[model samples]
Target: MIRALAVVLFALLLAGCSPQVETDQARLCRMALPALMADGAAIDILAETPDPDGRGLAVAFSARPSGPVPERHLAACRFREPGRPRESRDLIGLTLDGEALGEARLFALVRYWLATPEGRAADPAPLGDLTRAPVLSRRAAYALQMALDGLPLAAIYALLAAAYSLIYGLIGRINFAFGELAAAGGYGAAMTALALAGLPPAPLLAAAFVMAAAVALGWGFATARCVFIPLRRARGQQTLVATVGLAIFLQELLRVAQGDRASWMTPVLNQPFALARSGDFVAAATPMTFVASGVALGVALALVVVFRWTRAGREWRAYADDPLGAELLGVSPSATTARAFALSGALAGLAGAIMTASYGAVGYALSATLTLKALAAAVVGGIGSLPGAFLGGLVIGAAEAGWSAVFPIDDRDLAVYALLIVFIALRPSGLLGSRDPVVEGLRQSRS
Candidate 1:
């Protein structure tokens, strides 16, 4: 494993040395083209015309038909001038290369040329009137492409799900501080990456993974030992209260330490790569940091496997089945709980770190809401079922993404939460999750 990791790190280093293209525009184009093409009245065309400078082609599109058109399509595009590739300006005036036309212009020209009276007579067809001017710019298509890739959305959901699932599986209690732990992991790894900027991408990834794992483990262990353990010993609702207190305390600490200043993970190792190409549209490259979710999932699985098969795992299962019997067998409940806390905490930390880097920012205030949602996901997955937690995370994540995609729900903070309530009402045990022990116990005792 070490050797393979080393090779990957080395390859990343070599890859990083190569130049990366600015991807924002390319990504946008990918999204715009397909959507534009889908419109009944929308035209799919590209045109290149001349520019005075002659270094690059001057691109422009025609305005779409005006007034109320039955078609719900509106074209949007942007163009960048020479020497300012990063800065996009409106594509005004004439087309460059004097040959290829911007999508809008090409569509317009096609309509005009094809619909000319004499030309129509040659083909024997009546031409429709042009209404709205094409509203698309070169920049618009590029922006569209970025949105369509859905990678950023994917990364966000993946992180949230992983964190919730890991915590729910090992701790058997929602950790309010899970988001903070994720923040810590991300900030910690990001800082480390910044410090080791000279390292290759693979090494940077490895380093971030290791740092995140360490931080998560430490945080989970400390929280469980110092807080949850005491509460569990006392037993009952006290545990829940203590967790809440700990969560608030940690959030405040993070706020004080970092302030409201946005914290971000270093993407020094990230390089842009094209995802797809269709005509003039292309998906931009994104930092590979988002891929860290895979690592998180793998670690989560390893933990589950270890819990299921290892000697320690067997002991844990035995304790869960019969605490007094396990104690008679010489297994220490305190020790096992401590171990579980450590494992859960570490997973949380790793998730936080992955998310921070993936999203590019972390704040103390962000914890409460995310944690609550994670809890919802956990419950939805089915408490005590590790696999269920993972599945639940995906469902929640996907639902959240799909909702955002289809509707403008930004103002509705409770929308996602409301969905959670619905899930609980509809499937109390969660899609694949099992019932809480208390409920199960009551049923068994009654039986």
Candidate 2:
């Protein structure tokens, strides 16, 4: 396992060093930097946007050159197509301090802007690592930012909820211990990153995520094997009780390992690209959020594909629909349950790694909150419905974000729980739940 992780980390490192791919803002910033530096000017933007006609990108700039007189100017990076490669689009000129320079003049520089003394200066130490592009709008920009914040959260909750749904569908039982399992994954990620403190950020994070997934996968599979499998012949309440006990045990074990304190990893990708701007707020999103969301999306697609097409998935579905019939048809219950639990654990681990990478802190006590939220998400979406779980996560995450944006931040959790309560009270079957969840439960129980 260690060797495999080492290989993965090495690959990530090699990938990172392979090329310099610039995001739109990064590209504009990179182009603007040398020109701004040449004139000893700094940029403060109210808005930056691509041309509606696709000519190039333009940014409103307040240029503060190293002169007694500071001036404001309009700046743009002209390109045939904004999305094309560097060699494709020739920049016309970036005007700084009333001087216009062509791409050749700007591109040919004595020193790289990223390494230069003037370009390196930022308000804070960390902002130096980022490029800024702000779009002006009070409502639209703030909404965009909220979406960015909420999407990552949605991605995380969706992952957990999906795990819940997967296990529930397989065994007709919920693994309440998944939250603890996620925390274990976070611990694994943190410890791995801490151990590899000397590695570059990208490789370090890659290794951490891999470790997190491995740890969670092992624990999840073991939990199913040791705790849930034996209780297969027992009542639902008994399985629930067993898993809850397992949850508590895992939490306490982790807490003891942590010496009752959270372990923190050094921040990775803390610098955000300024996406838009409202009056006192800049809608900022880091690359990490997008990455997390993408992973969730990818996982969701993979799950969908597996469930719809694979023979194992068909067997699992048959077992879920009718256990005795599936068994008679030659499906091995043990093998099916093991694979299902392992996949669920891997999903949990991915969630943990994302949470850690985004927040940079992990604690054992977080297990309960995570588990409860994920459970609520699952219940709200449709306990055994994979698509519903993802949708429910989005609903909860969006609600939390919107509430925090407009209302008091401290009562955010209250709002989330209140929403869950309303869902439970009004639609116990959830948004996309079975037509008769009560009937399904009774049927499963009798069988």
Candidate 3:
């Protein structure tokens, strides 16, 4: 793993050393100038200057006299929308090319220059249709938007991770099928909403949440009772493999029953509340984001209180520390395990319902991605640690949002997995994981 990471880092360094690529303005100049210049005229692009707002660029070019052209000619070409490379070609103009410049080309050039910051500053008439309100800058807007969008998602991840951690902490076994429980929750809510269409918003939403939790709870209980309990005496690997197969089975079952189409929920909190604004750019969040995040946080906090204060919580912890001892003491291992699964499923279901509402859609494929991300959170924060899971979810969400600001949209997932790899390499035990007593003993002995 270390060697693989080293290789990846070395490849990234090599990529950084690659040659610089041409700018959009330069490429556009090369394509447009030749067609407008006199036959055999030597055209050279001198320099390209971006407008103040960075939305457009002015290209200066020199054309040597050739054929009918008798003297050196210099002219400037401007692009109104520098980011839109395709549209830029139709907006170029030539000066020294003289009579060779066609009416169509001249018209395009005029529009391009008029759209530039300099041109707009000179005469705002060209952009009369555009918004003149104060708004955030483009880059700032994008970054803020991503951060806001990631908050609720992070909360959902926290809930999912917490569920996984709870189950693992109690049972010392990974429930690979937990992701399917989440998906089932989401699908349950969606179906309920459909069946209860035309109901008041409050009742509809309440029904969705209740139905989702109930469905997920039932699934978790059955899995524990029918599958996990029977395998309790079996090897750990056997249980792990069983859960994986179960996960795949559940995913396929959902796919066949729901069809491949994504089910979309009606917009719950669709009203946008702008947080920052400059010119045309705006950073905003919806009510749903805050509400969902708040609910997830509340659930996590409630669980913390329960575990710290309640009798059942004490029993659960006792079982986690030593199941055999707890069972010997009359703490019904089966009952505790069942309760843990049910509680975990309830949390997972709630998370799924919130996520589906936030995204407005749910599908079978989403389960795998969510599972992987939640697992990454659990591992990075400290496997089997609730606080660590929440912290890790936030870290992953922030990293993903921040990386998206600088990298291509398609590479976002790559950035996420890279973060996971780095965390694994640097802190295999996770951020909050307790040190292994065996490893500590080994170190002490060596000393």
lDDT of 2 by residue, 1-447 (tens): 999999997986576544222243334444455345435466555445555444455555565668656566665655534333344224444555456665566655323442356544432212222344555778888889888989878988999999999988777788888888888888888889778654545677779888998999999889878987777788548888898899989988988877678877655555476776666567778777877888789889999999999998898788888777889989998889888898899889988888887887888888889998998899999888899999998888998899988999999988899989999899987898787655486447633
The TM-score ranking, best first, is: 2, 3, 1
lDDT for each residue of candidate 3 in 227-250, tens digit (9 for 90 to 100):
777877775388889989989998
Find the 10 residues in a row with the least total lDDT in model 1: 123-132
lDDT against the true structure, per candidate, is: 0.56, 0.75, 0.72
Model 1 ranges off by over 4 Å: 1-172, 268-272, 277-290, 409-413, 435-439, 442-447
The digit string of per-residue lDDT tens for model 1 on 258-327 reads 7877776544424343444444444444455346546646765786789788988887677665666778
Please tell me which model should have the higher lDDT, number 1 or number 2.
2
- The parts of candidate 3 lying over 4 Å away from their true place are 1-142, 436-447
